[model samples]
Target chain A: MNIKIVKTDGDVEGLAEQKWVYSPSVKTHFFHPENLVEDVNGFDDSDYNGVGAVGSPACGDMMKMWIKVDPKSDKVVDCKWQTFGCASAIASTSMLSVMVTENGGMKVDDALALKPQNILERLGGLPPRKVHCSVLGDKALRKAINEYFRHSKQFDRMVIEGSVMVDPDTRITDRDIEEAVLEGADDMDKLQKKLKVGIANKDAYAKAEALMGKFMEKYYG
Target chain B: MKISSQVNKLLKDHKKHDIYLDHAATTPMDPAVKAAMDPYFCDKFGNPSGFYEIGLRAHEALEEARNKVAKILNCSSREIVFCGSGTESDNLAILGVARFKGKGHIITSSIEHHAVLETIERLEKQGFDITILPVDRDGFVNPKDLDDAIREDTILASIMYANNEIGVIEPIKELATVCRNKGVLFHTDACQAGCSLDLDVKELGVDLMTINGSKIYGPKGVGCLYVKAGIRLEPIVYGGGQERGLRSGTENVPGVIGFAKALTLCQDDKDKENKRLTQLRDKLIKGLITKVPKCFLNGHAVKRLPNNVNITILDVEGEAMGLFLNELGIYASTGSACTSKSLDPSHVITALGLPYEAAHGSMRFTLGHCTTPEDIDFVIEVMPKIVEILRKISPLDLDSNEVQEGHGNLHYK
Candidate 1:
């Protein structure tokens, strides 16, 4: 679905969805033209070939990109993203994800070669300081993808069902979503029992539960 | 009345270690001027207004100092009214004129220091109409704009003699001529221009002018306003009759004496010092241009203060540069002390239509009577290194090799 990413000085076309976004100076968001968050949550492991996130609070921009790859064809079937920054940063990340997916699976070398100007031109040119904003998305996308292959052992079933494969080093154990309205847990004891010997250990479960509580409070409360 | 030796040593250490390049902020008092003030603080510390014999002698000395200041400014002693400082002088002039006239229009430039701008703002709230004239790229307000901005109701037109941030000298005499022809009172905040430029009240045709003692290498907390003969201005501060009933306060005898000495000394070496200062200013500007790439001078090249060299270095943050310069014991200012607390650039720079990057990159360097060639050399040598280190770590992409090529192309062009 085509999405319109409106920035302060310009805009770009992309398939919009949430990943992780950051911008120090100003706030922003991502959504598809269908008036809903893109179906990023439904992608299976084979569909999650690569992802990238860039920018820091110190530098004032953050962008995260997710890619779903077709194993048989070695092609990018779908891509989605989220960003937190001024309007330009959000638009750049959204446009970048669409460009990579539309051109098939972006090779590591090709993604690295993408210039800030390319994203800027696509978004109809940003203000001079904001040119740096585009670079963040490019860097994040390449890093997330490279990380997937570098730690492939961690996620042995790279093409699992109903899970987007993040960097191989990054596995979403059941403990990661223990407090997140788990379709399985009945109460606190069940939650704790599942967490104790879960694929992710107790400490990881505790942290993830805390994060889920915060996410619920922030978005649902 | 002498300060403790420990205090003296502390002050001496401050002077020896900190290379103050903010003379436009305030100057270190000259030894001779300080010595001239010694008598007024100690043995002869009598109230000049007292009727005693010692008081009469002190009164006579005070009159002599006034005459000296009056002489340096090319005005009669009767026209000069000593005030607390430059800000007070500005307030007194604007409020006094607006109050005395009862109701009238006022015209001033957009880049005026808050001393004038805030005073005008206060007057505006109190039913006075004010027109803020615009300035050009070089920070020069057109004389024609002043002419057009004037109205039949205009009672006074106030513009600064030189901008504090950019240091661009305005066409004060030209504007004064227009005001004179229109029969409107003219005031100028000559605080920044006091010691650096000549003062001829008659030639400039100004009805009121502000000068700061601190700006002219004298004592702080004392300044004077020049109100031309027969100009009706009411006193803003009311109390015992003083300053020919224009300003009423117990006179600051020592500060006045020091101010007089500073002005007299400045007048004596005006020409030679102006030339010398221009040389140092030029050398500094040239050094920056040759050493630093992607930098542009902010103010007027030819029509600026003899001692001012303000520039904007692209891709480097001003606050970081300020901190790094402080670490090296070299003192300077981003623009004005008023706006230094905020990480933002000077409004004056922004008003000149500079991009945010250029404005945030600005730095002001002002020399003074005590600034030597050695100081300039040291600054020229050390400044680029600091800028280089800052740009390297800055988020703005400013690699030296690309910048060097750009600089080479600029020179070749």
Candidate 2:
């Protein structure tokens, strides 16, 4: 037997299957994530028709995606993305990009219907605590689809996912809380800084604060 | 799944992970320590509790190992309680003491190992008032803070000698003095500090201390807790009434022998190893800070362990950096939640009051016996490139949020 030091088993390939902690599929996407926009600043957005983003870097997770839609059939032709997130988030986003554009692309509505559960299932599974990461990709995809609807003058198709309006005046919706939470507004004070919902109207502020709690629990719980 | 099996095989076949930088997690057993333990598994297999000749020999060996460890610790042989592992020792020290008292106020730092923190947490559920003192930016638990937190009902203060994550050594003697003045017991988990620091329990003034074998090039699954003479602790384990009735089980004779040998070796070579490891550690820290942009060290500059270098490189995730580093055969650890099952960033890094985001990019490299100057250089040269790649791939706007105010930035102290 070798004396003092044992070599770290050279099983770099085995890092994919972390037994119960991570499945092989989750690791595959993490180690070799697909459609990664290498430089978001330098990305050529001229080819893309729709752009959407969710979460924030300050929250320790953020994702932005761009998709080109085939207007004739409303099919997503190409997708590119970038993220500041963890293994689960990164892997989910990478798989999301593949899901939208593979086999000549998923229809725009079909892509919008995709959920965190689908992503979680595709990745085999994430640890129960890390289920939040799987939500990043689906949320960003929803944002992109909405952006496409707004741009192409299909106002009827633009829908915010199950969100109620926080302030009908400033047009601050409960959706704003998710974005604000993503942008690092963890508490009411930070939320006030970002959305400024409670400054002029006490009623609006109270509504905003309650919504912020709801969103924080939803995103972080 | 463009994850081509061909590509994975090609990558695996070409790489050799010869570097061993994550010593804070565990260390390889020394050959001498292993050789000394070989006979105990077979030839000296008799139970130390038996009355036969072979049993008597085993009993003598057990006492000899105890004396050797106690001599280094500057404590009596009867004070040392051998247990299964560092976690088990921590459980014995904190739970053993707490369960004896039934229920009372307890004080501990936010940076303690889960073995201490979790045990205390469980105690809290049983109706104990718990105070978790916060640390400063460089992860220092102020002695005055410990002094302030002590109460009339405070039974014990269980703080670590050095943190496993950042290698920041706490003010143990000062903290111990506060507990002594307040008539409360003190325990320190010195698992990470044992190899590099002085283990003289008298000088440190700690009432109890825990040390582990896996961290000191001995066999894993063996740890010792120094319980001051005349101090009472209830047994957490119950069986054959080994370890002075404070522990009950058939003793792990080989593990104890290996642990004593490793502790003796550490005592003999500590100064020289510390000097050599310190040079390498500083070089890696300095080199990474120079090579990478907007990165800062996580712990006290001079008061940290000689072998630990924990830094947070801006604009990247630590797990991504770890995978890239692995590709080059360098194994280190990161504080990124992506790498953990809990999905929460390191509580120690978070306790330093770093923005939650700062915890995502933190990487820890703990040097050990197998590490050479060349390994440090290789990391210094390669780590920055990996960070650069991750930063470019990341979606956050570099300017607006790269140095964004608040959260976890500006942690250098």
Highest-scoring model, TM-score: 2
lDDT of 2: 0.81
Where is model 1 more than 4 Å wrong at Cα?
A1-221, B1-17, B336-339, B342-344, B398-413
TM match of model 2 to true structure: 0.85
Candidate 1 lDDT over residue span B269-324, tens digit each: 87898899999999999998899887778878989999898887765556445654
Model 1 chain B, TM? Answer: 0.90
lDDT by residue (A1-221, candidate 2, tens digit) is 11122236844444343222377788788767889876555668887878887664444566788899988989998889877776777889999999999999999989988976788888898776566666667767777778888889899888855767665433456776778798778887666544434433468779888877877788787
Model 1 gets an lDDT of 0.67
lDDT at residue A73 of model 2 (Cα atoms): 89
The CAPRI quality class of candidate 2 comes to acceptable
Query: Residue A173 deviation, candidate 1, in Å?
Result: 33
Choose the strongest candidate by lDDT.
2
DockQ of prediction 2:
0.26
> Pairs clashing in candidate 2?
B355-B407, B355-B408
Where is the poorest 10-residue window by lDDT in model 2 chain B?
B404-413
Residue-level lDDT for B349 in candidate 2: 82
